[model samples]
Target: MSQLERADRILDTAQDLLLRWGYRRVTIDEIAKRAGVGKGTVYLHWRTRDELFLAVGAREAVAMIEAVAAAMRADPAEIALHAYMRRFFLEAMRRPVLRALFTRDTDTLDRFLSSPARQPLQGAKLLASREYLGALADHGLLREDLRPEDLDYSLPTIAFGFFAIEPLLPKELALGLEEKADQLADVLRRTYGPARPPSPARLAAAAPEVVEIFERLAREYGAVAYGTTKGGDPEHGS
Candidate 1:
């Protein structure tokens, strides 16, 4: 197999172990064995366990970004603030590793939660950045009155609360995933969306820019996850 393909196999094994066993309990030897590679081979791809798992999270983030970007391209209305959050929330929820990363699930991530390796995962937070919010506002998809700084906090708080609170609620009282996503979308719409829907023309015009943001995020995160970026190269020096 090619070097890239072997590296991906190691990553795939690491991600599966991370999801099934959590970061604290997964080990390089086990990952190597599972991937049908020697321990040295795994180290060739990732210098340390922390770096490996961080790549796992980055990969998941790239996948989620790509999925959302694809959805936006297929339906420009998905570029609307509410629709964007809804799709993003659902995508994160559907991916267990990504869900853990989003919510900072201590049970799953343990000390890796605070490790510097967590930095690349911040790429996902770009959705809440001023540049992104400004782009949406420019298209009249976001509330005109709200500043990007205001949204930087509010957007993540509202969307993250759903993930943070779900496990705390009683199963009997808990809403189904789709129901919760719908409610979250409704709240985001009321809070951040334009007072009225943007015209179809506006949504269409916004689609390219909005989708580009996510596609850019996917490329960046993929580079880090797959060690394509300079400092991100695990094979050299992560």
Candidate 2:
């Protein structure tokens, strides 16, 4: 297989293993075996097991960003602040890795999520998410008065808190995730979004730049995840 195809196989295998067995139970050898490649071949893409799993996480982030971007392309209105947030939560429900990241369940694979080796990948994803929100504000899709830092802090804190804390509530009172997501979206849509939606022209104008911001982040993080850049691999000389 071509290197890119082989790398994708390794990551696909690693992600499946991660979801089936938490990070601690997963190993490079098993991932390689599942991908029908040798251990050395796995290392050819990722220098360590940590790097390999980080790549899986990176893949998940890229997939979500691409999904959002695709929606924006199809309907510029998808760039509107509330629409974006609503779609994000819906997408998160569909992607197990994203739900894991948002939940940050310490009892599960939280160790790998919090590991030092994953920082760059994590930072890139955060930067992209934050920057995209900032872009929305810049383009009149969100409240212009809102500070970027506040926008960055509040949205995730609110959405993740709902997911993290919802389980603690009485089971009888708990709503389905799609229902919860809609409620969350309504709350955020009223608070963070503009009093009135932006014009279609404004959203269309901003879509290209918003997509570029995320694409750039994906490339930078993908390089590190695949050990393609200098100092990208923690196990190797950096």
Candidate 3:
């Protein structure tokens, strides 16, 4: 198989192992064996076990970026902060990888995700999401008086709070994921929405650029996770 294909195979195996056995238990040799490659072959794709898992996380990030992009492309209204958050949360909840990253459940991949080296990429992704809010503000789709720093802190706190707390509640008391997301979206809109929403034309124009910014950052994350320079081709990377 080609290098890229092997890399993908390794990543797939790693993710499976990670979900089945938390980060501390999964070993590079096992991933290699599952992928039908020698242990050294895994090192060619990712220099360390942490890097390999980060790459798995990065792949999840890419999926999220694409989901957001697709949502915006499908509905111009999604460029609005509320709609975007609703879609993003629902998508994140649906994907196991993303759910693991967002909620950081101990029974899941929390140990790997909370690593010191992983902090930078996690912080960068948060910053990029904040930038998306800024993009909407720039287009006048958000409140005029909103401060960037406040936004940088607020939205994530709210989203993270929901993810962190929801599972602790009794299932009978807990709302379905979609229902909760819709409520969260409404709350964000009421709190941050512009006095008058932006025109569809404005939203359409802004969405792609914002999505592109996220996509670029996600690629940088993948590069970092795989121990390669940003924008490096998967096929060619060591």
On residues 74-144, what C-alpha lDDT tens digit does candidate 2 reach at each position? 88888776777788887876788767877775544758767887676667667777788888877877776
Q: Which stretches of candidate 2 lie over 4 Å from their true place?
A: 229-238
Return the top candidate by TM-score: 1
TM per model?
0.90, 0.84, 0.88
Question: Which ten residues in a row are the worst by lDDT in model 3?
Answer: 229-238
Q: How would you encode candidate 1's per-residue C-alpha lDDT over 52-149 as one tens digit per residue? A: 88788788878888999999999999988788888888999899888887777888888888999777557565653566688887777778887777
Q: List per-candidate RMSD values in Å.
A: 3.4, 4.2, 3.6
Between candidates 1 and 3, the one scoring higher on lDDT is 1
Instruction: Select the stronger candidate by TM-score from 1 and 3.
Output: 1
Best first by TM-score, ranked: 1, 3, 2
Q: Provide the lowest-lDDT 10-residue window in model 1.
A: 229-238
Q: Against the unseen true structure, what C-alpha lDDT does each candidate score?
A: 0.80, 0.75, 0.77
For model 3, residues 1-238, the per-residue Cα lDDT tens digits are: 6566767888889999888988878998888789887776777667778878878877777787777877777877887878878988988888787788778767777567667657667677767777887787778888989865678778788867778775687867858888889988989999989888688898888878787776777677767645542343443433
